[model samples]
Target: MARLRRFLDRIEPQFQKGGPYEKYFALYEMVDTFIYSPADVTRGSPHVRDAIDLKRVMSYVVVATFPVLLLMLWNTGFQANNAISQMGMTGLDGWRNWVMSTLGIAHDPNSVFANMFYGLLYFLPMYITTLVAGGIFEVIFAAVRNHEVNEGFLVSSMLYTLTLPPSTPLWMVALGIIFGVVLGKEVFGGTGKNFLNPALTGRAFLYFAYPAAMSGDAVWTAVDGYTGATPLALAASGGIDAVKEAGYSWSQTFLGVMPGSLGETSTLAILIGAAFLIYTRVANFRIILGVFLGMVATSLLFNLIGSDTNPMFSVPWYWHLTMGGLAFGMVFMATDPVSAAMTNKGRWIYGALIGFMAVMIRVVNPAFPEGIMLAILFGNIFAPLIDYFVVQANIKRRMKRS
Candidate 1:
C-alpha cells in the first residue's frame, strides 16, 4: 500500500500541496484537489507506494451516477407501461389478447412490471457488453504500452449510455461503445490524451451512422402505438401553434414529463447529481455556473431576436435548461477536465461558447431539434484552441508586467 501511494504521488499532481488558500472562496478548489491528491496516481517512479488505485476513481463515477440510474428505472417503466397499454396487452389474456387486440389496448397493472423487467434486461446486457468490449480494448492497449488501465472508461461508459435514448437497440449500443472505446479514446492514446469526450464521440458516431435509430423521434414510451415526442421537438414543431398556450408548460419541462434520452428527461435528478458532484468537489463549479448562465443568456437572446418566426422561437430561454439533454450534457459532459479548457479563464470561454453553440443549434438548425449533444462535442473540439489563446494572452500580460 505504501508503495502504491508513492507511485500515485509520482503521477498525480494533487498529492503535492501547492500552497495555502488566501480566501474562503478558494477552499472548494483546495479541497477538491486535496482529498483526491493522495489517490491521484503518480506518473513517475522513485516514490512511496500504496493501494490507492483506479478502481476507486471508477467507483466515484458509479456513485455519482446513482441518481440518474434510479430515475432511468422509473422513467423507463412509465414509458413502457404506457406503450403496453396502447397495445391492449394488459392481462393474462395477454398473448392471445395481444394477437387479437391490435390497436385499442388498455392499461395493465402488469405492464409496468413487464416494462421494468424488459428495460433492465435489455439495458444491463448493453451496459455489460460495453464495459467488456471497452475493457478488452483498453487492457490490450494498456498492456502493449505498459501502463495501468486508465479509469477514464468509468466516465465514458456511463456517459455513453446516458446519452442514448432508452429505446436504442442492444446491438447498436454495443457497436457504439466499441466505436467510442477504440476510436474515440484508444486511438488517441487513451483518456487524458483524447481531444473529445469519448462518450460523446461514440454518440456522434451513432448519430451520423444511424440517424433514424438515434433521433429524438426514436426516443419513445414504447407502448405499441403510443408515440413519444421529445419536448424540444414538440415545441419546435408547434411553433406558436394554439396548443402552446393550452398545453406543454415550461414547468412540465422542468419537471421532466417530456420525452428525451432515458436519463436526461429529469432535470431534477440531474441537479441532484450535480449537487453531489459539487459537494464532493469532483467537479469545477465555476465552469458549471458559467456555462449555465451563458446558455440561459444566449437562449434568451435568441428568443428575443426570434429565430425564423417558428413556434420554437417562442420557447422561453429558461426552457432550454430543462429541454433535450442540455441539463445532463452541461452538468456532466462539458465539465470533463481533460477535454475541457484547462485554465480558469479558458474554462469560462469554453463553457460560454458551448452554451452559445447549443442554443444556436437548437434554434437555428431545422435539421435537429436537440442541440446539447452537438454543442458539447463542438466545445470539446474547440477547448484546445480556447486554451491556446488564453495562454498566449496571459504570456503577453506577464511580459507587459515584467
Candidate 2:
C-alpha cells in the first residue's frame, strides 16, 4: 500500500496543472485512480455520505462478470478442441493443431486443463486487442476533448468482449469498440450521458457492418473448417428435434456447454453473475423478473400454437430460457443501468418488452437466430419514453390526490 501510495504521489505532481505532463493528466489519473481510490472526494451541493463511488460501481460489475469470463475461457477452448477431435482432423486445423499435438494435448475438449489452455489462447489475444485498440481510441478522445477519461470503458470494453464470437477477427474487435465508444457514447457526451450501452452499440455496428464475419454457423466455433449451429439456429430451422438431432440437449445448453459467444453460452454462469449483481443491488431485480416473466409467457404462447412447418414453435419455455443469449442479455445487457428504463414502473415495461421481443425475433426471424442483442438495443431506444409515461402517470395520480 505504501509503495503504491508513494509511486502515485511521485507521479501525480507531473500531471498537475502547469506541470510538464499536464496535458496527459487524464491518462495519469485513469491509471492512478484505478489502483487507488481518487484522493478527490465529493465536496459540492447534494453531496451525501456514501463510501461507494463510480470506480466501485464499475469494479463491482467487472467482478460480477468474472464467472462468465472464466466459463467463456473453458467454453472457447472446448468448442475449438471438440471441433478438432470430433472431425478427426489434426492437420485440418493447421498449425494450432500440429503445435497442440506436438505438446501432447491436442484435441481434448473435455480435458479441463486443455480446454482452459486453448480458451486462454483465443481469449487473451482478443482481450488484449480490445484493451489496446479501445484504450487508444479512449485516450485520444479524452486528450482531444480535454475531458477526463471515463472509467466506464473498463466495464464497456469487457461487456463488448464478452458478447463477441470467439472467432471474431482482431481488426473487427478494434473497429467495433472504436465505433461503440466514439459514435455510441462519446458523441453524446460520454458515459452517464449516453442513451445506448456503448458496448452493445459497438456490437450492433459489427453485426451490421460485417454481417458475414459476425454471424453464420462458421463463426461461433473456434476450430477452423468446423461449423456448429447455435441451438437457436437449429430450433429456428427444425425446432426442438433439430436441436436433439444436432446432439445437444437442453441440459447442456442450460449448463452453458454449448457453442455460442465467448461468455454468452451458459445460463448457469450468467445466472451466477446475476445473483451476485442482484444481491449487491448493482442490477435492478424488477428488470430481471420482468424479462423472465415475459420470456416464459411468450414462449408458452408459442408452444401452445404449435407449428408443423417450423419446429421452433414446439420448443418449451425452459428451452427459451437456456438457448441463445437470453440469460446473458437479461442478466447483463438488459440491466445496464445507463441505458435501461429509470422509473420503477418503466423498468418492468422495458425489461418485459426486451424479453418478449427477443423471443419473438428468435422464433420468427430465421436470418438472425440470436435476438437478445437487437431486443436490448430496441429497449434502449425506448427507455426514455417508458419512463416518461410512468412519470406522467405519477403526476396524474398526485393531481387527483390534491
Candidate 3:
C-alpha cells in the first residue's frame, strides 16, 4: 500500500496543470481516488466531517447490489437451462455453448454451478458493454468540462445492466447506455443535477423505441426462441388464476425463479440488498416504507373495485410487492439521493407517488404490465416540487409561530 501510494504521488505531477498529460487528469484522479481517499482535505475551523464520502457511498451501493447480482446470474441461467431442456435442444449454437462445452459445464438447471456460469456468460457481456459505453461518455464530459469524474456512474451502469433482459443485444446495450449518459444525465448537467434516474431513462428509451427487444415473452428467457410470459404479464392477462395455471406461484416470483429482467425477478434478493443499504444508511427508510404503504393502499383499493374484465384488478397488494420490478425499484431507484426528495416529509410523498403510480400503471394500462421503472422515473420528475412544497409548508408554519 505504501509503495502504491508513493508511486501515485511520484506520477501525480505529470498529470497536474501545465503538464503534458493534464488533459487526462480526470482519468488519473478517478483511478487514484477509487483506490484511495482524496489527498485534499479541509484544514480550517467550522468544518463538518463524516467518514462517508461520495466514493464510499457509491462503493457501499455496489456492494449492496451483490445479492441481486448473484440471483440475476443463477435465475437467468436456470431459466435458460430449463427452457433448453424443455425444448430438447441438442446444444446452444454460439460462443456461449462453445465456452460451456470447453469448461465441461452442462445445461442443467438443477446444477448451481452450471446455472451460475451460464448466466455469467450472458450478464458479463451486457455489463461490460454498459460500463465501457457509459464510461467513455463520463470521461469525455469530465475532460471537456475540466472536472473530476464522479463515481455515480458506477451505480448507474450496474443498475442499468440489471434492468435489462438477459437476451438484450450488445449493440442495444451500448446504445441505451450511451443515450442514458448523454441525454438523460449529461444534458441536464450530469449526476447530481439530473432530475431523472439515468438508468431508467435509458431503459424507458429502449422500452418505447425498441419495444421488440426490450419487452415481450421472447426477451426474458435467454434461449433463442423460447417464449415465456412473466408472472406480471400472466397476472395481467388472466389474473392470479392465469399466473397459477402458468405454473407461477407467488413463492416462485418472490424467490426469483421466474422469467423476468435479470435483477427485477427476485423480491427476496432485492430485500436482502435493501436490508444492507438500510443498515449502511445508504438508502432512506422513509421512502421504502412509503412505497410499500402506498402500494398496499392502491392495490387494496383495486381489489375492492374488482374489475370482472381485468384480472390484474384482483391482484393483492402483497403479490404486487413481489411482482416485476416493484421491489427492486422501491429499494434502489426511488431512494436515489440526488433524484429523490431531499426533505424528510417530501420523501414520503415522493415514495407514495411512485408506489401509487406503479400499481396504477400495472393495473390500468393494458400496454405495460411492469410499472416500477416508469413509476420511479415519474417520481423523479416531481421530487423537486415535492421537496419545494415541503420546505414552503415548514416555512409558513415557522412564520406563523413567530
Regions of candidate 1 where Cα sits further than 4 Å from its true position: 1-57, 90-118, 223-225, 240-247
Model 1, residue 367: C-alpha shift (Å): 0.9
- Which lDDT value does model 1 have at 197? 82
Give the per-residue lDDT digits (tens) of candidate 3, residues 22-114. Answer: 999999998888667676622221101223467757888898899999999999999999999999999568999999999899999999999
Q: What's the residue-level lDDT of 216 in candidate 3?
A: 90
Worst-scoring 10-residue span by lDDT in model 3: 41-50
Candidate 2 accuracy as lDDT: 0.85
TM-score ranking, high to low = 3, 2, 1
lDDT of 2 at 380: 91
**What lDDT does model 3 reach?**
0.90
Off by over 4 Å in 2: 1-52, 91-104
- Candidates in order, TM-scores: namely 0.80, 0.86, 0.89
Instruction: Pick out the ten consecutive residues of candidate 1 with the lowest summed lDDT.
Output: 44-53
Q: Is candidate 2 or candidate 3 better by lDDT?
A: 3
Clashing residue pairs in candidate 3, if any? none
Name the best candidate (by lDDT). Answer: 3
Could you give the C-alpha RMSD of every candidate to the true structure, in order shown?
9.6, 5.9, 6.0
